[model samples]
Target: MNMNMDWYRIFWHTAKLGNLTRAAQELHITQPSVSYAIKQLEAQLEVKLFDRLSKGVKLTSEGMEVFKYVEKSFTTLQSGEDRLQKLKELSAGELRIGASGPIIKHFVLPLLDTYHAEYPEVRIRLSQGKTSDIRERLKTGQIDVGIVHFPFADHELTVQHLANIQDCFVVGHAYQHLSQKPLTAHELSNLPLLLLSEGSSTRKYVDQWFSSQGIQADADMELSSMDMLIELAGRGYGAAFVTQSFVKQELAEGKLFQLHTKEPISPRAVGFAARRDSTLSIAATRFTELLQ
Candidate 1:
């Protein structure tokens, strides 16, 4: 189309006010300039945009259709401009974050709390799911950054290791009567165990460790939430496999005891992931800095 944005704006104003003189005054241009712009636009589109009415002007069928789109475009442009202005003024901007439930609860929440305390005007939007799920969101631009466990497979993303995590089997005070000596993999296989759902990183790591020792675990229950697993273990449901840091408070308070393992589980890296080429929001960058 030969019509430029300037002509579209002129046509939009004229259609709204239904008078060339009024539109020109609103636009701070001469009436002929408004008329010429509309005429040019109509000629380019090969459609009559306005019908000369006795009192003023009325949109023809084609004019109404064009005006409908122009109206929506201008509204959207105005909204974008307003948002940009707000961002420039530091009055508003959204921070989208992706994380698993455990990480969000144990790590992201505290950092976000501190961030919100400092920047109360910034809006935070959090999405929680499995590490793989969060990774997908990060890749697709659905979230600005992700808090994920280590060993993520995506090569296109940049990762920053924030903390080292150790996995441990925790049991309640009811099991305190057991000896404090380290339990062999073969011995642990015979005890009732609570674990995360199959295919989870935690579950995979546990399974690998057990397999290497030629032991078959007696998994009595599968739970989705680490908090629930801790609660159940505290109630003597079974020995639950969880991150040591996650249950540090329970361990310290004597509500739970860590079962001695013949071989301590290797520590895994927990960290932030972001698209290699995407620009991060100020809030997200600041939060990442705190994690680092």
Candidate 2:
């Protein structure tokens, strides 16, 4: 019927208080205004909603029936508003995130720890995958934010640079002598090279770096996991290309040694991305702010 909601609001308070004056006081309106609204409502519904009494007013049988649904609808609306406030405050909500395993562990974990500590009521959903996979999830609305290797280019996403990452070749005791001096790209390529498997952003960057130096990076061992590559490289399998920050412990402990190249490897970056068209949930926004 497209009736005015103000009429029903006045009716609810009036029915509850059983006094038009009190309803008007609660609504911050004149008693005559309350009476006029009630009259309009009754006329629209084509029913007597209240019985005028000397003391106050009483709901008619028809008014009681209509009140039931009105009460439920208003209650539901109030509940929705309360939940939205909680979400806005970051006291309750879900944060859906996606990233590669290594980035999640080395880059995103500390930020998550801070976020969780502050907003313990927020539900965190973390999905581990390649950068490409993370982007796909963002596109499909499966994830609210994505942590990926940059410079990531996607017209559909708004990306913010989080941190810089340096990729270098690491080796074990078997190749200890090679780390003594900066080797040429040809010399480095000729050594038994270990690398992350194809289809990863890191792998693509490494391949491009080698190509730019006029060398072909032929991996003696290709693996899907950076940890596996590090493990294999540490066991003296071959020199592995990996993020420098991720192998700090091993480097400090002399388990894995960083190799120097005659040509410096270009440093890349890590960034978080979200769909440009969608608004991030409060929890996600706060988490990203913490990361920043």
lDDT of each: 0.87, 0.92
- Report the lDDT tens digits of candidate 2 across residue range 91-201: 899999999978988888988988899899999999999999999999999999999998699999999988888999999999999999998889988989899889899
Q: For model 1, how does the per-residue alpha-carbon lDDT over 205-283 read when each residue is reduced to its tens digit? A: 8998898988767579987788888999999987889999999999999999999888778998888899999878766
In angstroms, what RMSD does candidate 2 have relative to the true structure? 1.4
TM-scores of the candidates are: 0.72, 0.95
Q: Which candidate gets the maximum TM-score versus the true structure?
A: 2
Worst 10-residue lDDT window for candidate 2 reads 282-291
Cα lDDT of candidate 1 equals 0.87
How far does residue 118 in candidate 1 sit from its true spot (Å)? 2.2
Model 2 / residue 126 / CA error / Å: 0.9
